[model samples]
Structure formats: structure tokens, C-alpha cells
Target: MNQVLTQKPHDMLAATLSNEMAAVNTLIQTRMASEHAPRIPEVTAHLVEAGGKRLRPMLTLATARLCGYSGDNHVKLAATVEFIHTATLLHDDVVDESGQRRGRPTANLLWDNKSSVLVGDYLFARSFQLMVETGSLRVLDILANASATIAEGEVLQMTAASDLATDEAIYLQVVRGKTAALFSAATQAGGVIAGAPETQVDALFAYGDALGVAFQIADDLLDYQGDSTATGKNVGDDFRERKLTLPVIKAVAQATAEERAFWMRTIEKGRQDEGDLNHALALMDKYDTLSATRRDAMEWVTKAQDALTALPNDPIRQMLHDLADYVVARLA
Candidate 1:
């Protein structure tokens, strides 16, 4: 009701997501606490309170609740999802050398990478404990595969950076591996715990994968299009890092000999000057890469909604459908 789902002033998708996420806040809190280690609470609380949309865990719980699941495992599953997400954030800061997150100085910036990495390890271990408590090997397998895929994706992103030869196919693989894998696992596990029919379970997985891919692509597009105050990151931070995103990748695919020389000198070599950013963006516009990337993102959102057609016509399902549209529509 408060419309706090997004930091964006006009974004309704984030608002819808916020409403669903608000329902799971209590579960997130109760499970973030630890009895055995006093340090666990302080470290975990510091990061949890740092603020996130809690989208992953919210999907887990919302999907489970939508399926008429009456069991309490949704609580643990949701918490487990958050822990995994937080762990990734912590490690991501270390890897990216990022000093800020959620518009605040990051954990690594505040306490140093050592603390961030160690605390992240603790959360990973704790998440495993929560999953084990569920006594569901099937759940374990899903999360375990996600963890491996996440690690692999991170490494792949690192390797892909500054590679002028990177193509759109590899870019999509990186997105799926790094971003969508966990989302799919989170939603799929929700249906699994609900013991939903196999068809519905598969649908949830497809729904999440498409939504996550669209979400990441939208975020990438926003880097070139969004207001700096709203996104909480500097415009073109990806460009600053010489990272190849969808727009840049698409632009590269169509670059002429002269345009390729500019990209190789700037994005690939990190030889940026003041006007170089505008020049890079000009190339993206020249090749219609921004529009193309946005089209791809919308297609994924459509696919995500199609996956949800199997869900019953309920308020919750409608909310998810609207949320998918909202994720990509923000850029428009």
C-alpha cells in the first residue's frame, strides 16, 4: 500500500514486487537470527538491514503460498534464498572491488574484503544448515547446483570482461548462469515444497528464468538510460569497468572497422577520457543496440508471463504477471 517496492518514483513493477515482499519480511527476520554464535547476528543483521528488494525470497514464498502450500518449510526456504543472495552480494563486492551497494558504502568498503568474504562464507554455511533442516534432498540438489552455477557465472563474467570478441550468445549464457539460475531455482523450489504437479513446477522454473533474464537485461539497459539518483549506481559503471553488456555487445557485433578501433581502444583497453563515454553511447545508438537489447528483454518478459499461464487465475498470479511487465517497462 505504501508503494515502496522500488526506489524509482514512477516504477509500478517494483511497487507490486514490494507488496509481495512485505508479506515475507517477518519470516526473513526470524530466520536471520542465530542462537549458537553471537557474532552471526551482528554480521548478518548489518548486511540484511543494508536494504534489498528481497525479490528472490519473496518469489519463493509467494509462489509457495500461491500453490496452497500450508506447510512452514516456506519460511526456511525463503530465508535460505536470502542468505544465498546476500552471500553472493558480499562476494560480488569483493570481486568487483565495489565500494558501494544499495546506495551505501559496501561491506567490503566498511569492514574490508576479508570480513566481507568471511561473513559471506558464514552465510553460505548457515544457508546449508537451513536447507538441511528442511530434510529435503531434492531441495538441496537444486540449491547446490545453483551455487555452483553462480560461482561459475561469476568467474565467466570476470573472464569475459575486456574481451572485445565477446558475442551476444556468450553474453546471454553469462546472464543465465550468473543471474537467472538462482531465480529459476528459487521459484522451482517453491513449487517443489508445495508438491505441485511436475508441469506446474516446470512452469515456475521457466517463469523465474525468463523474469530474471529480463530483469538483468532491464537493469543493464537502465545503466545507459536511467536517472543516476534512482538507480543508485553511476551511469555507465559497466563502461567504466570495461565490462561488455548487451548493448555494448550488440553494438560491437555491428561495428565497422573504425568503430571497432574505438571500442578496442576504450572499452577493451580501458583507455577512457572524458568524452569517451558519450562516444561509446553514440556507437550503441548508431547500431540501434539499445533498442535491440530492450526488444530482447521484452521478449523474455513475454515468455515469463506465458510460463505463468498455467497458474490459476488468482490475485497473486496476476501480481506476478504484472510484475514481469513492470520489470522491463520501467525503461520505456
Candidate 2:
């Protein structure tokens, strides 16, 4: 057989869905515009065009196409997913007090927090309008539930932040809420719009859920070990912020009493000093938590790929499987 090399899996997926994605971008631009409040578009545009991978929307389009859908509503749903994702990001940057996003200053930093918040709210309302235009109440329900879950997850993370008692189970719950909920919703809405069989829809949901968890786990791991230019944030941002992500959580689980006190002083009490991040990294290295976290991420990747077996045997299915592996491949 002739072998053909390709770009990254997401780039290949984007090439496959270029036409639909173009439509989604057009719709996003059109919907993000506000006649009276020009700042809405200004702030929204800053973040929306920040070169995000648009992976969530692509999931919607790919799943719909995989199920043999032949309608324009898929485009609408794809745009809807993007809007929801963008809205949450705007809110997140403000809440996290983040200074950077997508390798640029965050909207909250460039513009005011007020602008980011109101624009995010505007995009959210616009997202509802787009989904309603699809004429599928079920699609509306899935995205709506996802929006709620995202908010709940952010709230949960706020409460769990810097708390040494936070465990793996709580970490997973927060991950599912903040990250996986929208992923599953995007895929599930696409399948539902295509009128796919219950089994296939379930599989799509499972695949998205697992992929999202894996994606988040990889991101958390990167915080301690990744290049700043590639990750778009300084290494140890999570540690400096006192956010107890999975790698730290794993290390905490195996901490000796003295080690536990270190975590408590830095994370729980928020009294971090110079060289504290290095000390924390050394402790995680001592427990080998980074490798353990990578293993957990790989397990989720397997689950995501396994879910694809229930879907049709199409090229898109293969791309979806590759995408799952690519997410974890970042760790390498």
C-alpha cells in the first residue's frame, strides 16, 4: 500500500472539514457583532480569533458528518459550540485572574473585566439563539446542561483550590465539569442532530467524555514541566496559584507527614516563598507523580479510542481515534 504522511491530526481533521469550519467561522463573526455595543465585538473578537484549535466545534462537525448527516444545521451547531466555549473562556480568565491566554494578553487584561464579563454574557445569549435556530430542542437541552455544568465546575474548583484535603475523586469531578461536560455535549449534540442510533450517540458521548478528561490531565501535567512558549503560560503557574491539579494530588496522596506539611504551607495556606515551586516539583519527582498522572491520562485515551468502535468505520472515525492519541502525545 502507498503510504501518505500527514500534518497533525487536528490539522488533518480541519482540512477534512474546511468547508463546514469556514461556515462556522463566518457565523461566529456575524453572531459576535453587536450594533449598539461595539465593545462586544471588540472584546469577543480579541479572544475568538486568538488561534484556538477550535477542537470542540470540530468535534460537533466531525460527529455529524460521521453519522451521515446532510443538513446545514450541523454548521449552526458547530458555531454554537464555539460560542459556548469562548464564553466560558472569557469568564474563566476573569475568575482565574489570568494575565495571558493563547500566548497573548487576556481580554481581561487588555480590556476591562467588565468588558470581558458582559461580552461573555452576550456571547452566551447569542449561543442560545444559534442553537434555537437549529430547531432541535434536544440540542438546546444538551448545550444548556453543559453551560450549567461548566459554571458548577468552576465554582467547585474555586472551593477546592489550595485545599490539601482535595483528592483524586474531587479532581476528576472538577475536570468533568469544567472540561468534559462541553466535550460530551458537543459530540452528543452532533449525533443527536444527525438522528444517529442510541448506541452510536452513547459512544460519541463516551468518546468525548474520555478525550476531554485526558486532555485536561495532560494540561495539568504540562503546568509543571512544559515549555512556556508552547503552553502559553509560565511553568508552575498552577503551583504558584496554589491550584491542586492531578500531579500534585497524586504526590499528596503519597506524602509523608513532613511532606504533607509542605503542601499544606504552600498550597493550603497560600504562603509560598522563593524556591517553593522547585521544592514542590522535587517532591512530585520524589513520588514520581508526574509519570503516574501521565499513566492516568493514557488510560482515558484508551477509553476514548475504545468508544469509537461503536461508531461507523469511516475516515473520520480514524481521525477521531488519532486525535485521542495526539492529545496525550503532547506529554512525550
Candidate 3:
């Protein structure tokens, strides 16, 4: 059997789009500064300087280039996408009550939730200001809707997180709102900014939506199986948090009465023992939900790749396709 080598899609994207990415980073630094409040810059810089793949902004830059855009607004738009993403992370860490992010102390932990929340609001405001500079109502609409959708997804997850009744459809809805909304908006706005044809623009949206779904599913799956060092997350973190991610949802769907009782005790009641994580993994293994979840992630990846078929046959398009595959390949 041939062992498949895992490819680094974001590295390829960064290498190819280095110039535009540099412009985006510069703009990010410029906009994140606040003269009225030094603390705002401090909080923003802490998270921004932390090494993230900048995948969302790269998607904006790459899609704009793929559509043959030669204008300057794409850089601003790319920065806008990144600010929104970073802001979301700030808010998410606060909500998750997490101590670590990107293997560093979370901003909320270092400073306070108030700082993280206010700074996140500031970033969101800056993102809106930057998007408005594009002078495209369509771009504003798409990004605004995505921001709202992301908030709604977070709220939905709040209600659904520990509920055993949460189904796969509800899970996908949450994924689409929280993760895929920004991705689809990123690509869609890029195409719109470039004045690409409607078909190509829609194709870009589809590709992004599918790619985001695949990415989130892979991340959720990794919470159970990934190396803590490599993933910057402890295994079974979601289980411990009672997030009701896909694998656990699958396992819950097929859970026997006794297994369901265990889930109810641990997840619904907020009581967990040291052995609970191992037992959850054992149940998942018994049900083979991990493999089933991996299959679902691959299906989304294929959907993402298929959506790229409508795009131009170019290196950018090929990179996008490979990116979709590499999302799931992290699981392998």
C-alpha cells in the first residue's frame, strides 16, 4: 500500500500569495491600532502576533487573484476578513472560558473578559469600516450577514451543546453559521470585488462553504484523536466541554440504553470522572463513529473539490482543490 504524504495547502497558498498577504498584514497592524486606548492595541497585538495560518484572509486574496483582480481593495478586504476572524477567536476564548489559544495564554486569561470582549467589538467595528471602504454594497451585505450568522451559531451551540437530542442536521447548521459563513463570505466578497461573473462567484461561495464545513468537522474529529502537541488542543477537550461534536453525536445516535445513560451522566449533568474520557473513546470505537465521522468529513471535502470544477482551470483552482483534501488529510 502506498502511504499518502500529507500536503501543506496553507504553506503553498502563503508562498503563492505572499505579496498580497504582506499588504494584508500591514493593513491589519495599521487598523488595529487605537489612539484612544493603548490597551486595545495590546490585546489585539497579543492575538495577532501569535502564529496563525491566516487561512481566512489568504482565501480572500487567493480568490481575488483567481478571479484576475488587479485592484487595491482586495487587500483591505483581506484585512477585514482577518479582523473578523481574530475578533471571533477573542470572543470564543472568553465564552469557552479557555486558558490557552495557539499554545499561548488566551487574551481573556491574560487580561480579562471585559478587555477581550471590548477589543473584539472594536475589531468588528474596524472590519465593518474596512469593508465599507470597498464601496460595494454587496460586499458589505455578505460580510455583515456572515458576522450575524457567526453570532447566531454561537448562541445556537449554547442551547444545543449538551443536549443528546441534537441531531446531525442541527450540527451542520451550527457549523455553517459559525465556520462556513465567514468562509463563503470571504470568497464571495473576493469574487464580487473582482467583478467576476455570477457563475464563478457562486461557485466560489459553494467551494468556500464546503471547505469550511470540512475544516470544522476535521477539527471536531481531531479533538478526539489528534496529538495535543501538534493540534494545540488536548484530546477529548470537546468531550470534556460537552460540545456534542460529530463523532459523539454519531455515537449518541447509535448508543445503547446503557451508553446513553453514561452520556447523560457525563454530558448533560456536568459530572465527569477521570475514566469518563477513555470510556467515551471506547464507546466511539465500539460504534466506529470515528471512522464514520471521518467519512463524512471526506464527503464534504469531495463536495468542496467538486465545487471548484466550475472555476477556471488554473494553479489557484488546483490549490483550492488540494486545500479541501488537505483539510481532511490532517486526520490521516
Per-model TM against the reference: 0.91, 0.98, 0.98
| Model 1 spans with C-alpha error above 4 angstroms | 1-40
Candidate 2 lDDT by residue in tens digits, 66-165: 9999999999999988998898999999999999998999999998899889888988899999999999998888888888888999999999977888
* Sliding window of 10 residues with minimal summed lDDT for model 1: 1-10
Judged by whole-model lDDT over C-alpha atoms, candidate 2 comes out at 0.92
lDDT by residue for model 1 over 1-332, one digit each (tens)? 12324433223333544644554566556666677756556766777887777778878877887787888787788888888998899899999999778777888877788878887898898789888988889889999998998898889889997898888888888898778999999999998899888889999999999999999999999988887788888899999989999999999888899999999998888898999899988999888889999999999999999999997677678777877877876787
* Candidate 3 lDDT trough over 10 residues, lowest sum: 1-10
Question: CA lDDT, every prediction?
Answer: 0.83, 0.92, 0.92
Backbone collision count in every prediction?
0, 0, 0
The TM-score that candidate 3 achieves is 0.98
lDDT of 3 by residue, 75-117 (tens): 9999999999999999999899998888889999999999999
Model 3 steric clash pairs: none
Query: Of 1 and 3, which scores higher on lDDT?
Result: 3
Alpha-carbon lDDT of model 3: 0.92
In model 3, the Cα lDDT at residue 272 comes to 98
- Report residue 121 deviation for candidate 1 (angstroms): 0.6
